[model samples]
Target: MTKSKQTEWNFDNTYARLPKSFFSDTNPTPVNSPELAIFNDQLAESLGLNAEALNTEDGAAMFAGNEIPEGASPLAQAYAGHQFGHFTMLGDGRAVLLGEQISPKDERFDIQLKGSGRTPFSRGGDGRAALGPMLREYIISEAMHALGIPTTRSLAVVTTGEPVIRETELPGAILTRVAASHLRVGTFEYAARLGNVEELQVLADYAIKRHYPDIEDNEDRYLSLLEEVIKRQAELIAKWQLVGFIHGVMNTDNVTISGETIDYGPCAFMDTYDPETVFSSIDVQGRYAYGNQPLIGGWNLARFAETLLPLLHENQDHAVELAQEKISDFSNLYQSHWLKGMRAKLGLFNEEKEDEALINDLLSMMKEHRADYTNTFRALTFEKHDDTALFGIPEFTQWHERWHVRLSRQQESKDSVNQLMQNSNPAVIPRNHRVEEALEAAVENGDYSVLGKLLDVLSKPYAHSAEQEEYCAVPKSAAPYQTFCGT
Candidate 1:
């Protein structure tokens, strides 16, 4: 298994220079046969990668783990997470980082392969990813990027001419994920649990330099890092709530210090408005329900803050007090972001004291009537109330009058407000049913047209048109919807 010396990637292995305990050096397991299934040409160009070079057989080999590119020091990162209220040691069981690539614009990104192969952290299971879930992540993550959400993007997907046994035997696949950095809250937790203050301090400084270089000179940089992470997570969750997205797993490891959304397992967008909605089948207790995301975000940040206590202050009690005060600000920060986004959705350009109640009342009515979350907001862009049938209810009609009165008091023009709502509310999301159908067709029948069609519609999320009207409808399934983690 000799490494190949040819590659189009510009590698900078900074993380590899960290302590040996931070990661396990390894190469991706070679698949029996490899074929390139999808390549993001646009993303490739942005990363300064030669897309033409990667679309060939040799490129497929590089992506499928048959050949390690030159300058790649592949490794499995170590982490620990509180999954479903239970803390456990975790790592890159089925994935491997191929080293960092500095883009043409001087931005750094980790090029990792998901479903590449087994690692030391496989934990008695086959560390393989099925084709369906890999493609699912490819579709949803790109869609999220198009919708203006900060998220990890897919560079390519390669199919392995092998089978993985899940609930049944499924075709194996590999996904190349690009991220700003792979630093997570759980990384710090792992260091703290080892009782190595030196390691923790080194990791903290590395994080600040990598992600928050502006705070490197500050004396209270550790405290500032904690505060910045909290603010980012709060705003991230606020955006998720505004878009009706359910992460389904808000565990510590899945929470990135970079503020980018990572790990797209068992994630879905809301079809209908229900504050307590839970989509992950494994979540029997609804611990990560839609309504609880903000609280869970704060809770995860609290865990992150705990790990920084040794570095936050010399006095332990003083550090705890500082952390608590910062954590307390999460609620107000989240509320401000949420209110701003919700107000724009309601076509309100100017803020008013009554805006909160007005927005909440509309959501309450929508929940009471089980209105479609995306459509209900999209409907507000229309001039005639009757044109949007979802608001045909008497309660909505009454609320509509109040909304109109509220709008009249504002000085902004109606056209400008309508434009604001149309921009804030997306007409198309990666609908759960549609996503399932696409995955089934591609994985079961090798039909990719449906998947391409869905991607085309989702790429223009803000564009409301008759052609994409069907995409706006919710599925009429009788059974409750559920999504699996595809472990």
Candidate 2:
């Protein structure tokens, strides 16, 4: 179909050009009297959008599905996933991919309207989303970007002038999410269900061209793609652990092929340095806990490999052996990445044979002392002496001495040590209390200033500011913090 050009959108919808079987041609359900909730102006410009022109009511209308953009071909992607280890059929239930937006710098991104409405995959519930959860995603995703983590970006959130009936009535909102691409492990799983290697090959080719174009000419591009994805995920999960970010839900569907964090449901940053911490109320098994992320990452990759078996090799047993070897390498890759990151966090400019033990010993002390994770790192970054709460512990003091000796062995100057730590460790994070406070103010009081300020601090996570210290403060209560999925 011929379409008019939208100057601001600049959409080049390659995803829609794919086979129709890959997605359902669907449009977002229109909402009543849509209003602009929030817009990421900086992100808009970076995405090569004409931010000024679309920063008004028209933008809200576009995001709220009241007015589809000229270049947009709204559709819901089809995918299946293993939810908490249980295989199930699922897809975009309340979201629609508008199209891929090509930026001026030649970067391609998938622009999607999440919580737009229901589709063929909505299952049996209202395909609507509440404002609070949408705002939470906006805040956390932006925070993740600032923390230098690969994640889906939030372009805008528009409030629908209607109440969504959850347990009780709640204000509705829609999130315009931008991503490297929405191709996930679940997509492969869904394609495998079609019972054809050609179908899977097409999807694999599309993904490789979009994300891993470098590997296209390889003799074994399929296996190479799997290895590349596995490595990306290993590095990605290590970064998550370093920053105390718990994804809460690590189901195969949520695992993106681009290694970018996708869904933000029930996600939060840890407070104290405890390996057993789990905030997702639904994660009763502690499957995706702070310590279990790397394992879950490997598990998810194995699922992805299973879908690619036919493409990997003609002999099923040989393919299994190849996939297993690759999966086995995940642990070493993850450990190497995590250890390297931990070294930077510790200001260890040079590697020591005992570095792993040193890092583990400190972590053990932190857990035993119930010390705040971010603050302890920040204090160590500054080499501050005022943190009696953590430094006062005898076990920690001994650990500090060992770390001091370790630092002493390095030829680098003290300034170098501090610089490395400052660069590696964030001065601020999207602390749970702070996030909740911002969401509460915006959703209940209609006060966005709280949220804006939090974003401002989060934007410069490494640079220390006196104002950032407020956000760095841990929640007063030691009560078990809980997180619930938006759905």
Candidate 3:
């Protein structure tokens, strides 16, 4: 075994101090040959990591599971989740948390290795990850962060110099994942299933201290915690809808209690407007389609609320009533957040009853005309007279007339409204076709230039660049695009 690599990760294994049943202490299984594929220098700096140390061979070893960083206690967390509406036990089958890091400013973050190797939760499959999927996550997750969405950031990707069998053998890789915390709705479910009320309380208290410290002392902190999670998830799904993001899989385990986007398995952003759009190949029923995210988010939160019943109150019926009341808030909360975002996209600062109808009217037209979601919104920012051709359709023209009358009532200057629209509407998103092209080039041809260029363009998703216009174009075909959950 390699000695602990002297890297600059300020490891703090707080989760490890929890009860033994919470996680299994296991080191990441080392690979044959490890090579550094990509390093996120900026992310490393934010984590108070020594960028110079992490870009070296030792860093590759550390990231690849060949050497544990100092002060680390690698473990596979225990959790059960509802996969596709079916309850099942699942855990870190292919990943391990390499402890947490406390930055100079005292912010704590988890450092995890995905696709590192098998663990106690590996079940019956090979716990190996492919290079293409790993790179895909790096690209998409970073793009999400740059687009001002909450998400787990990618720190590095390392080639394992081995092959893993899926449809066929593919190059193995490991992804270094950084997050606020890996505690999920499923984790609470896991504690509940153990039939230990004390354990459930422990997990809830720990979660509150780690994520929602403000309410730790409240008498009804557990209820407050549930409410807080509901709020974050509501706003999160709203943001995803505004940005045309599809999570592909809305499994309970994937819903983080901290409310950051987790598990970029089969996730994708829509190239065109369609309420029925689904990218996950496993989602044949479209349970998590583009338009169904808010609903699914509510469903998942209900599941989370179920696990908290034992701690909610003394009477089971009262607890159920309280939980249902909290869960019922999801729809209205989500709509309010979603409408606010939609208003910003349309450059409306003041809210009127008709504002929602105007926004929906535009969306309805976009769907009917098969308009590019990102581009259509972006096009609205340009001088309307100069690009009247794009919006010249009869339905859009009628809607534009109404929009102008609505705008005339606003007090904000035209330039200010345009600026707000530009900020709300992104110029670039991780289009499925473009992302696939970059992944294929790197996986098949060993060329990373494509990936680098895409990252550069995505890093400034709100900025306009004439040279990067090609990145803004939607897919040519309307055929259903599918994404795989690279298991």
Candidate 4:
């Protein structure tokens, strides 16, 4: 029987009209040889793609940088960013967007391939990615999506059928990344710096139409778009904190206007409940730490607001004041979403005025006791004191008492609340140690079994699985590991 093809990719290139300076018109540097590692059939079908064609030589060739698809306007975008609080000009140095594909839901997603080869923005560096990082992105990004967070999705990963050097020889790879649109806060910042308000407005109008079409009817649509973007980002960062996700590198360029988490470099989930968690090797200062995520997100939005000032109001002073006023809303919006999310995670149904204080107290205790964040919540799902075996440390017993008292106040049935907590709090996260272990097996030993198993476990992170119990455990002290930014 012949496999059915889902060829509904009606291509439309809107961003391509924004002038030459917005991006470099170039195709992905073709790889000499390419091989498919994984293809997201579900995502393919959703994007109205032919899954069978993607498995064929023609589809593989198109995805592997050997050929560009019809109607695909491939290009590397250009922008500037503040990296670790320092300003620098940067662009899609190693990634090329292969046009936008509208899903059956009418959501347009940029189907870009990272490490597709070099472009004008390569900046004297080899425009290639190692297989380990590619697979890491695939696993973690998918895991984030399953966790109900807004994030860029991984559609496919392909091996370059070759090796790339980075600290040693390693197998090279490419990742097909999908996002609402690749436009970032830094994209507007680039045009602002050039004193090109027209270009900035063009980009803003494009974004408004693509993401927030309803806003177009408003007179101050651009300003409203900016505010909406800020609000979305604030909520997104709050979600990251609730889950203990440290982005590691929160550069302006990495802050998407779509508010989806982008660029999975040096990103990690917390094992221990420490606010000042830093996993990215390049993050010398704790700029993108777990606790500081909110502040950093606000800072990034402020940069975006500055970029929009020229288009916000007629007078310069008035625009500045209006922008500042709008930016001030970020903190409150973030806190509101964060507190509500934490309440659900803690299985609190009662709305006390001091609920924020109550939540903070538990976090403080966890920090003092060095409790494993993921396991702490997972154990609570069972609400079994005997299962203190998971906590391992005796000091957690004190915090456990406080948590029980807080739970007692909830009016809901204990069993029902426990079920809600279990669903909200995942038993397993993409732990940094386990992620590195999987990478080592794949890169050093060519063993993908561990990687595949980890992917499967992360797919249903909140589900109770007897066979995958090891994944629910925190890393032993002897096996502690760290993640690095693959810059």
lDDT score, residue 156, model 4? Answer: 82
Off by over 4 Å in 1: 1-7, 384-390
Candidate 2: tens digits of C-alpha lDDT, residues 93-132 = 9999999898889899999999888899899967889999
RMSD to the true structure for each prediction, in A, is: 1.9, 1.7, 1.8, 2.5
TM-score, cand. 3: 0.97
Q: What is the lDDT of residue 468 in candidate 4?
A: 61
Q: lDDT (CA) for every model shown?
A: 0.89, 0.90, 0.91, 0.83
Q: Is candidate 1 or candidate 2 better by TM-score?
A: 2
For all predicted structures, in order, the TM-scores are: 0.97, 0.98, 0.97, 0.94
Per-residue alpha-carbon lDDT of model 4 for 1-487, expressed as tens digits? Answer: 1222234445667777778889988788888677777778877888888777786655666677787776778899999898888878888899998788876787788989899888898998789998888988988999999888999998888888788888888788899998989999888888888887788888888889888898998999978998899889988998898788888899999999888999997888998889988888787778888889999999989999988888989898999999999999999999989988888888887677877876777677678877788777776777754443435555556656776787888788888787778878887789887888888988788788898889889888778778668887776674544677664
Q: Tell me how candidate 4 scores on lDDT.
A: 0.83
Rank the candidate models, highest TM-score first.
2, 3, 1, 4
Question: With candidate 3 superimposed using the best TM-score fit, by how many Å does residue 298's alpha carbon deviate from the native?
Answer: 0.4
1 or 3: which has the higher lDDT? 3
Clashing pairs in 4: none
- List model 3 lDDT by residue over 384-464, tens digit each: 432323366777778888998998899999999999998999989998999999999999998899999999999999887
Task: Show where candidate 2 strays beyond 4 Å.
Answer: 1-7
Error of 2 at 474 (Å): 1.1
Give the number of the best model, judged by lDDT.
3
lDDT-best of 2 and 3: 3
